[model samples]
Target: MAQLIDSLRADGICIIVVTHDMDLVKALDARLVYLIPDRPGAGKVSGGPVQSPDGPDGSRPVLLPVAAMDQRDEPPRRSSRSAYIASINPAFRLIGAFLTALPLLISLDWVSATVALVLELFLLMAAGFTPLRIVRSAWPIFLGAPGSALAIILYGKAGGATYWQWGMIHVTQRSLDLALATALRILAIGIPAIITVLGIDATDLADAFSQVLHLPERFVYGGLAGLRLFSVLRDDWSALSASRRSRGLGDENRFKAFFPQAFALLVLSIRRSTTLATAMEARGFGGTEERTHARVSDVGPRDYVYLLICLAVPVAALATAALTGRISYFGN
Candidate 1:
């Protein structure tokens, strides 16, 4: 049961299981989903009692006993409370995630980027995202930034007093500054964007998007389904890439081989999409009713502060450049 839950978690599936087997529920670490049922006399809580584990000292356990899903005769039917809460509005999570990426998109100054990166790091730390994961995710940005900066230096020399000239190219002091600025800008934007979204859980993101952002329910659910499938496809792609390398296919890298592999991945993605769609439809998704939150996403006061700083830093940098005559608007 623990393994099953782990697998479901890895696949980014949101599941609310029902079971009478107490041990299984404990094993699965499932959360109790309470539902209030309408009775003839009065309304009463229809869900089963919430049980919790005892502590190491035999005190009451911290977490409540949630239902475990099981394959058995006469499976437990979902109650209104259980079903309603189980389906989280994906809008909030999605919108929040997108907004979190905003700082990286607009900020250009090193100071702005630096501040944004720090704030994003703070959020990740607060949200329990591992530092190792953050570092691992942010490294690629540095790897690519230099190359992009080099491109700007090589190509952005038009109308500059050429210090050195070659075929279709010129090098100047201004070009050097432009290269450094471009590299810094890229690093500033890329690092925060990656870290802010790296630890996001897809189902929670979907729920947040639906509830907070008021996105169309069908679109939110569809995106969730796609995200789940993408995880599987990414894993498959990695495996196939490795296998091909081992089989000497990687040794013979030609245009033909690349096209076929790309095509194969496309076909695999389509098949996975079809299979996921059919499975979701079979499970009675998109039922006629308003969805409720299984969990809620909140933007803390810290997020607002960070957003303000993201907006302010670039403005400050521009202001500083203006006062110092260092700011050149796109070399105009």
Candidate 2:
């Protein structure tokens, strides 16, 4: 393939080599200049490789995948932050994130939760996500965690001395402690989970599902198709909203206008899904023959190291909680 590409370049035939293979570019020592057509209808794609005029001897290849791509950077520059993340296998990242949070469920004591959160915070910083970046990417986790904590604070079965009482809401020492533990636990579980999946490519995850996890190809590819079209839904919603505004419905109550807009979006989704299904069937995806993947997604030494850290964090948290006499599983 390298020889063929070099021969083609020599023949003055410039072509777009679509790939997500960073190693291929590095191995060929070829620089890529990404181009997105200046057309609104040109969907913002995430990964495509455009060979630069500079051939193999030019310079080291820098990965700059050109696309706004799912509300990410437009003509995205490969930041160091994303580079660290993109190195891991998507399947292992998914597994590790869950593993790191799972052992925290051994006990819901504030000690364990706080210790785990602190360790996770350090790890997140080490992974090139600054405090600000983590929050920006995982704001939903932050918002939901506090809301959950607030509910616990308000009505979490008052125990020990009460601090304040107003109607059904009682602020007690035990509730305060429980709320703190709940908040910390949510952050501990949610932050790393969010960060692991920050820049995950759907194709890579699909490949991982098929190759690493041995999932059915039909299910994996169908999932990939769904993820790809999810961005289209955003575009469809925006277009629908704009169309409504043009028809002078923009000033109407948002709550009242929501149902019609939702119904329209659902109709559009069904039409698109039908077309996509037809296309997939035409491509032989409906056949019983086993399909082969063009790329591989396997765990490496780094992945093992990451898995170790995931195991260690929760163990250390629980151990520390036990030392403080705060750890109790299932209220035992």
Number of colliding residue pairs in model 2? 0
lDDT of 2 by residue, 1-332 (tens): 87788788779988567665766665555656544544454434445444444556665344343443333322322422656566778888889898988898767778998899999889878877789988898899899988998998999868999999999999999888888888989988898888887777778788888888888777788878988889888889999999999999999999999999999999999998889889888767899876655565667899888888888999999999999998867564
lDDT of each candidate versus the true structure? 0.57, 0.79
> What RMSD value applies to candidate 1?
13.8
RMSD of each: 13.8, 12.9
TM-score quality measure for candidate 2: 0.65
Query: Which candidate's lDDT is highest?
Result: 2
Model 1 misplacement above 4 A: 1-136, 159-161, 231-285
Per-residue lDDT of model 1, residues 101-210, tens digit only: 45345433344444445555565556555677556778997788889777766776655567776776777776766677667666555655564444455766665666
